[model samples]
Target: MVKKSVRNKAISSVLGTVIVLAITIALGGLLYAYSQGMFSNLTQNTNINVQAKIIVNPSTNDSYLQLTLVNNGNLGINITKVTIDSNGISIPINVYLPPGQQYSNTFPLTSKMIAGETYTVTVYGNSNNKPVVETMNVLASTV
Candidate 1:
């Protein structure tokens, strides 16, 4: 009677191990399928036209004005960085870009323009030589 009970227990253990192994293998196959599709997700099928709307930076008496940009693209974009120049002053801006997003930038008004002088702050992109949009005739005050 004792020998019979021990053999039955051993058999039960072997069956439980087999069931666990089968379940693990099935779940492994499911996970592998999901991993393959995740990379192809979020891809845009349409053409992307990058249009940027320049938002001029705010200016004060002690500091220069700034600008913000709106991306009107259909997909995501990697903007390199921001560069600003008008008349003679050059300004550098830290920038990041996303699809249909907006970012603000500040460019100093170091150019020797008199108070009440009007200037055009042309905003250009890193990818293209052309300006996406230009904020022209901004009111400048020397104060």
Candidate 2:
């Protein structure tokens, strides 16, 4: 009588197929996430134009800043931050505006504002975590 020994493998053909398919699906998912980030970056890098005006309330003896943002790009934008600075004074604001939409905001003055002074206003926009910046010069009322 002759004795024969058989070896058993851990992974069969079907199990190997399943493992390959799982790895392929995981790699595909990772690639999709990476491409999404890249596309979002491309979309956010856009040209943004914002118009600003500074008005002083003579009746109230106070001054305020006004801004009109026009979204002329093809993509929608979300306003993230608005800042005004003059003579080392900084004012920060939060605003949201959409594409092809017009929005305005009035920022009150905390200190005495002088006439004929120049103020810089910066607006920041985001589209899919991408940033867009627009800066404008606002001259105070010389009245």
Candidate 3:
């Protein structure tokens, strides 16, 4: 009787160990699959970043141009230079862009401009050493 009880107990212990190991393997496989899906989606959506439209308020004179720079990129705008081309005119604007922040830039004019003339503002970007250019259209009609 003693021998039979010992044998049965040993068999039960072996069966319990096998069952627990199987459960562990199954859970590990499930976790691996879940992690793979989560990481794949994260990498797929982080391609390009850009900035949004900014509000501008020109100075008291039509000869000067004021700008509000907004960082629409996932990073900083990294403005290299701000240039303006008003129908037969051209000038360089000053800029200072903070990371994920907005700043106002004021450009001094070298010539007189009309109130209803259209002007183009072009921003050159070099964040992360990669050069990019963006343009915005502005007019002197409204304040």
The CA lDDT at 43 in model 2 is 59
Report the lDDT tens digits of candidate 2 across residue range 1-143.
98788788588889999999999999999889878774554454355678777777666768777777877765677787777765454555556556567777777767666667788878877876788788888888833
Query: Pick by TM-score: which candidate is best?
Result: 2
Candidate 1 lands at a TM-score of 0.41
What is the clash tally of candidate 3?
A: 4
Error of model 1, residue 26, in angstroms = 46
Candidate 2 global CA lDDT score: 0.72
Q: Tell me model 3's lDDT, rounded to 2 decimals.
A: 0.57
- Structure candidate 1, residue pairs in collision: 55-67, 55-68, 56-66, 56-67, 57-66, 57-67, 58-65, 58-66, 59-65
The deviation in Å at residue 72 for candidate 2 is 0.5
Q: Could you tell which candidate, 1 or 3, scores higher by TM-score?
A: 3
lDDT of 1 by residue, 106-141 (tens): 445454454565655554444333234333456665
Error of 3 at 123 (Å): 1.2
Q: All predictions: root-mean-square deviation over Cα?
A: 12.6, 9.5, 8.3
Candidate 1 Cα misplacement greater than 4 A, ranges: 1-63, 76-86, 127-135, 141-143
Ranking by TM-score: 2, 3, 1
lDDT of 3 by residue, 60-137 (tens): 444566756666445544566666655444444344454556766556565666666666767665656666676767
Highest lDDT: give the candidate number.
Answer: 2
Worst 10 residues of 2 by lDDT: 38-47
